[model samples]
Target chain A: MDWTKEPEESKVYPATHHFRVIGDETFDAQTLHEICKEYDLRAPVEAGNASSGGKYRSYQVSVHFPDRATHHRFHNAVKAAKGVKVVL
Target chain B: MRIAIGCALAMLALAGCVTAHIDYPLNDVKPQGRPGVAVSLELKDERYSDKHSVATFAHKTGTYNQGVEFSRNLRDYAEVFGGAGTAESWYIAPDRLYWKPSGPMEDLRDRLAEHLKRAGVLKDAFRAGMRDPAGDGGVQNPETRGVQNRGSGATLRVALKRFVALKARRPGVDTFGFFGVSAVARSREIVAVKAEWTLLDPAGRTLDNGIVEFVEDGDGSCWRAKNKPFVLNNRAARRLGDELVKALRP
Candidate 1:
């Protein structure tokens, strides 16, 4: 809608639901945090730790969304970003 | 600027390429038999590595390590549960963990179902709130009533731990020391393992208990890895679940 000559506007969705990501070293905490900040979502890694192995560190990441649509967009975008393994 | 843009695009491409394998329930089927069998599933917190600091004359050294130990105990538990045929019904919460299955659970459940089905046992697994007496012994039904009152389908809890150690020995020459020879030798070893599990009955009663112990000798490896009690915990649960189902068959 701006002077950049963009056509139709894309849909902006509300967030709901939560997702867990089990990844290798391909993606680090910093990279994931940046992505979460960009999408207005909470990474909530500490919470995941409580649920998973406490001191036995695994590359587990959990993120909360407002809805399915928002989750879908973010899921796709994150999976496509850099390093990620199993995401649920 | 162009290089930065290219890097961003590459990163995006990578994220999209990741894949996950999962299964979702497609249809509901009625399970045969009386409801007295209990299926237990449990998840436990992971143990961290031991840390110790040594102070020697104004100098200190610290050692740290971390990782999870995988276990295959779940399979054993499943074997015990699947012994009953259509005469008894097994109960467990039908979650993604139940249906889709993960590494150990997936293998354990699939194998149990296959064996149970072949043995002419295995009726149906039910979810909470959904009543189906004819399906897996309804609430009002005697069998179902007993199970409901008894509290069927719960996870068994367990705790596991691990450790590493070293040893020393006399050299072969030491054996000949009596013959005027002497020798000494030092060896490095890694010993690791820790685990414990608690069994629960259908009525949410703490029925029996089991323990898992593992010891592995390391060969001078800086990093030692072991998966015992974690695996054993699953086995214990399966065993307890199967036995409970068999014993409670009405």
Candidate 2:
């Protein structure tokens, strides 16, 4: 879920937030890293589980998000990457 | 992405040619008479009805009428199809360079439907199709055949009897050969469109039934995108639309 809908007090500025991303094989660690680096979030985006069909890969990351703006931008960027089906 | 673009262009194409109506029953018999003043319309495109004609799409690539007989590229069937013969070295499918409408007549049909609507003619449209969750559109299929009308107006069903096109090979391109020695002399395009419309009263008896026909023979430069033929193709559809308006409203 995006922070835009969440209560501001719950965000606790300068916090570490976890993001779960699902996409095709192209949305691997390196591909996600490009955006994390640009947004200045924690690096080494980790590859996680494969969907039941194995057609898609899941990625997990818990990084420092300075504010909702950065988190939103990072989410949008990930969503736009090649083969990326979703970003949460 | 291509579907999105086609939808966008479909919106634009419909904005123009704001005049017409469309077809049903895959009619071979002549239409008897005109339907009453249409307050609303339902449109159907029957391009997929004829097995001999194949609609073109970017991702699907253009395949000859018979699938097993030809490769997706120019090399395989060029040898046999009387349309165009290509040199053995030509490897790319011409579709790689030119884009064709998945169904041009369908696009034209939408344009006509839009015109009818603006004239205070119809209610909402039954879009072509959609994905799983709430799939509701006039997608041609066995189940779709049974889709009932909104019970407010007449129905228009359009069918393509025949369409064929041949474009001249590009300049400095000797790898592709045409059936004729001169590419310009060989370029050809044809379109045949038929629409049968039916209006039924609330009691389910036929109010009116009619047919509109549009046909053309022309030529294009090498690709579906390039020249004359595509323009001629659009013009031919307009001519057909004009006839429907005349027959339906006169």
lDDT of 1 by residue, B25-55 (tens): 1111113322211212332111111210000
> Would you estimate the TM-scores of all the predictions?
0.24, 0.23
TM-score of chain B of each: 0.20, 0.27
RMSD of each: 26.0, 24.7
**Tens-digit per-residue lDDT, A12-84, candidate 1:** 1232223344334455656656667755544454323211222111233335454445555666665665554
DockQ of each: 0.01, 0.01
True contacts kept of 2: 0.00
Q: Which regions of candidate 2 fall more than 4 Å away from where they truly are?
A: A1-11, A40-43, B1-250
Q: Distance from true position, residue B201, model 1, in Å?
A: 18
